[model samples]
Target: MESTSCEKNNVVDALTAVEMLAALEQYRAELSEKDRVIADLRSRLEILEGVNHELQLQLGRFHDVLKPLTVQLTHNLQLSAGRHEQYALPTGGARLKRLAISAEPVDVGLQHTPAKKVPKNDV
Candidate 1:
């Protein structure tokens, strides 16, 4: 009877050890899956950060290229505004004053004149 009891206890201990090993293997597989997910997320984040940095650089270059054009357009607009203001006034008074000071008589000319014939024998 003593020998039978010892054999039964040994069998139970062996079964418990097998269960523990199976549990350990399952835990290792879950940990590996979590690690793979973390690595993929990290890689994606790095790619996005690089793209964002490139976009910022491109935007800065665009602003630099447009800066001179914007300044030239503003200067041209100011000059045009000054010219418009000059032409907006009338020159009739100055013209009348100049005509009053002239001693020569004004003559009206014909709008269209007849064409004169050229002699072909002169060539």
Candidate 2:
């Protein structure tokens, strides 16, 4: 009876060990997948960082180029402003009113109307 009881305990322990091994294998597989995902994300982050650095460099270059142009533009504006009695625009709104607001009427029903074909490109 003692031996039989020991055998039963041994069988239960063996089954427990097998279940533990299976769980460990499953956990190992999950860990490996997570590691792969982490590596992929890390690579993508590196690429984004590289692009950001490149863009930053381009922005710096553009700032350097624009500095002189901005200075020149400001100087030119100052000169023009000095030439005018006042810096403000003319008060009459005459220029704005000069724009044509409506299209011209087409004489489509006229007997003299002839359909002009587009010229062919000979080249």
Candidate 3:
């Protein structure tokens, strides 16, 4: 009876050991998968960071190029505004009224005449 009880305990212990081993293997597999995912994300993040840096550099260059143009445009606008007082530029409504008074009335029905098409001679 003592031997049989010892053998039962040994069998239970062996089964528990096998279960523990299987659980450990599963955990290791999950950890490996997580590590791979983290590595991939880090790689993508590095690429995006590089792209972002390049874009920032391009934006700086664009701003540098635009700065002089903006200054020139402001100067031009100031010059034009100064000239506006000397030039008698027509106002919008006055120009429209002048154009309307000068324009001739159009005959809508006789506006367009299509040319007659000659019949093809089938020789």
Candidate 4:
């Protein structure tokens, strides 16, 4: 009788090592892809932040441009509301007045004049 023993123990270890290496490689690849995505997102965020900052600056400029108009409108509203005594212009109001489009006053229709009544005899 002849006894034959299979020595495939090393083969199993080698196969397991190869599979582990392949899994590690795949994991590395996935991590690199995630890193790239994160970097791309970061860059996009930066660009959006810059655009937001620019928009904010533009909005501020627009506000600055419209400040005089706003103040004038507020003053007009106050005048219309008969709050002329309460409404006082800021120091910059002088400059805004100089930039006024027209020196003509705007009528809010609050003035009233009494009409004299004459008695007439019945005909």
Please provide TM-scores, in order, for all candidate models, with all chains considered together: 0.49, 0.61, 0.61, 0.64
List model 2 lDDT by residue over 1-123, tens digit each: 999999999999999999999999999999999999999999999999999999999999998788667765755787788753233332322221243555444565764566567768843
Per TM-score, the best of the predicted structures is 4
> lDDT per residue, candidate 1, 29-108, as tens digits?
99999999999999999999999999999998897788667655655786878743233222322221121455343444
Clashing pairs in 3: none
Q: Write the per-residue lDDT of candidate 3 for residues 1-123, one digit (tens) a residue.
A: 999999999999999999999999999999999999999999999999999999999999998788667756755786888743333333331331233352333766645655457778943
Which regions of candidate 2 fall more than 4 Å away from where they truly are?
83-123
In order, the Cα lDDT scores of the candidates are 0.73, 0.76, 0.76, 0.76
Q: Note the residue pairs that clash in candidate 1.
A: none
Note the residue pairs that clash in candidate 2.
none
Encode model 4's per-residue lDDT on 14-110: one tens digit a residue: 8999999999999999999999999999999999999999999999899888988888787788889987444257655354333347544355462
The parts of candidate 4 lying over 4 Å away from their true place are 1-6, 92-123
CA deviation > 4 Å runs, candidate 3: 82-123
Clashes within 3 Å, all models in order: 0, 0, 0, 0
Error of 4 at 89 (Å): 1.2
RMSD per candidate (Å) reads 19.2, 11.2, 11.2, 14.2
Worst 10 residues of 1 by lDDT: 90-99
Candidate number that wins on TM-score, 2 or 3? 2
